[model samples]
Target: MQQREEKQLESALDSLIQRVNDLKSSIAAMIFKVENEYETLNWPQFLDNFALLSGHLTSLSKLLNHDKCPPLRNLTVLPLNLSPERDEQLAQLTEGRVTTFAHDLVPDYLRTKLEPMAESKMLHFEQKAATVTYENAQKQVAAYQKVVSNIWDIVSKTREEWEVESSSRGNTQQHSSVSDTHLLVTAIGMGKGLKPNPNANGAPGQPTGGMMVPPQGRPGSAGQGPIPPSTQTMTMNKTPSTIKTNIKSATQIHPYNR
Candidate 1:
């Protein structure tokens, strides 16, 4: 019975080791494909493929160091190059770690001793797997955040340029409006034909100005007379008492208020 149990244990270890070798081959194939297409592969697709490959590799690692068997850090025929020191190097490069268990290469002959060792290794593997998964996820998240920050930077720069262009356009429009107003004022002063006359229809056959002033009494009319050139000069020359009187009169009788 003891010999039969030992044979069963040996069979289970062989099967587990074979599975580990198969997984390693699969991971190697994936790695080769990724390396070949490193320049041309779509990043998001590659990330997904890499995630699947890593998961399989993780499974293989677990099997190789299974509690029922002795821990093996390096497989003779596997391409993973798995070792505690190498895993640390990988972690530095990929922001990920492939954990390994350190133990004797041969399992104990006694079932009592082997079973307990296996259970302890299993628990440790579970904890390590959880930690590795979380750390890998964090690295991926940070990579995604960097992309987001770059996009936001581009958007911010575009907004700044647009604001600058809009301000420049507004200034140009303001200058154009002032130029048009100045030109209109000059033409009205120099061209006698463009003068405004209030009593245009008073005389038959009398020469009238080109633009007739609109009659008063209409709602919202700008009053009966054109502003004289001397009005600005008179305002500039006003005494303090005169300016105060005008301000008082304007406050008492504003057209908008009335």
Candidate 2:
């Protein structure tokens, strides 16, 4: 039973080492494809490499977590004696002093085992994220306000212009109505042989009640009253020769008769 357990342990270690090596090779291949063959790299091949690396990592994790596997925390590094030739080769490659223990080459901080400060890091991250969110929210609010302000300005300007146009149209219509009324009054006055009173208190060109004046040149009618329809018709029918003879007689005797 002891021998079987030892064999299982050896097999588990070999499988774990093999999985690690596969993962390393996959990572190296992917890095090479990116650095050297980027122009000709195939996406399908890159994805396959990534999948293979993930599989290797999964297998390694399963091996480490298996009941037969020993705890990794209890493992210790064992120093090995290196041949002089190997030591010389390592010294040449590193270009520094060589040591048997790998930890001796690392900085003290890096070599020390550290417990994670999860709570502090999480709090700091939350604060930073909240700050960023607030800044973005403030920016969005300012932008929205600016847009709203611009829209309000446009609406106000449009309303003002509309009001001005409405007023202008109203004034034009009023003026046209007044002109039409004046024309009608003037036509009525002409048809009735009447004229607008010059001394009326109303607006110019408008009629005043009972203040209209009669037209000139009618028999038996004075400037104070309108001519009768019969008199107006008789005056209109008079010949030019008769009017000239009357005018000549009147002019000849006007001064002495007066």
Candidate 3:
């Protein structure tokens, strides 16, 4: 039973170790993929892909519980995104459709109107967001690695402890087996000492200690002389009647159905 339990523990530990390794490898691969994919996309596509990657990082961080890793995007600055209608109006203005169509019709006015959009959608802004996202993801990967390493350390320590325990238990069992063997040998030696001699001139049916042996009789007639066969048969036949009388008396008093 102890050996079976040890095997089960070893299996569980091995399974956990494998899972941790797989998680680590998966996180590393994903980080590499995100870095590679980020390099080729323009700002819009890059931002979208980064958002998806950030979601995955958030989920992985939650699973691994990495407290040191911060949020992927900054929250201190309020978002500068415009409402859909305002965004469409701004787009129309940029293309010189909302108001007038000409050469720099409203330079200062256009700069004022487009400033928030520029800050929200420009290359520098997106790059900054991407940088923060990538940094946090890297931190998450490091944290995940740390978690995996800690788990491996725990498994190693547990395996060492199990080995020590198993060795001690084996030693104990070996000592017990030796003791049992010694006891069996001693018992056999004692039995030999008490063994009766077959060549002794004792009474025909007497035991080695000179105790008179009883003749075979009824079952309850130990130490008695043997009864006649007819009498033994009669005694055996009376037992069933006595049992039936007792059972009837018991049932009348107990009245089981009532």
State which candidate has the highest lDDT. 2
Q: TM-score of each candidate?
A: 0.25, 0.35, 0.24
lDDT for each residue of candidate 1 in 1-258, tens digit (9 for 90 to 100): 878766766776787767766666767776887889778778787777778767777776776566665433322322333233435554554335333312331233212344876889999988887777777989989999999999999999999999999989887743357767777887767663365566677754344656544433533456744444466467667777687899999988887874
**Residue 219 in candidate 3, Cα distance off native in Å:** 6.2
* Span of ten consecutive residues with least summed lDDT in model 3: 70-79
Q: Which tens-of-lDDT digit does each residue in 88-136 have in candidate 2? A: 5566644545533244443332333533676678888889877777779
Write out the backbone clash pairs for model 1.
Answer: 67-118
Cα RMSD (angstroms) for every candidate in the order listed: 22.1, 24.4, 25.4
Q: Compose the digit string of candidate 3's lDDT tens values, residues 1-258.
A: 878756655665455455555555666665675688666656776566566656665565564444333332332333344232335555564454444323343444434345665766886777876777767989989999999999999999999999999989887743357767877786565543344556457654335542333557555565666565687689889999999999888888895656
Per-residue lDDT, model 1, residue 159, is 100
lDDT values, one for every candidate: 0.65, 0.71, 0.61
Q: How many residue pairs clash in all the candidates, one count each?
A: 1, 0, 0
- When sorted by TM-score, best at the front, the candidate numbers are 2, 1, 3
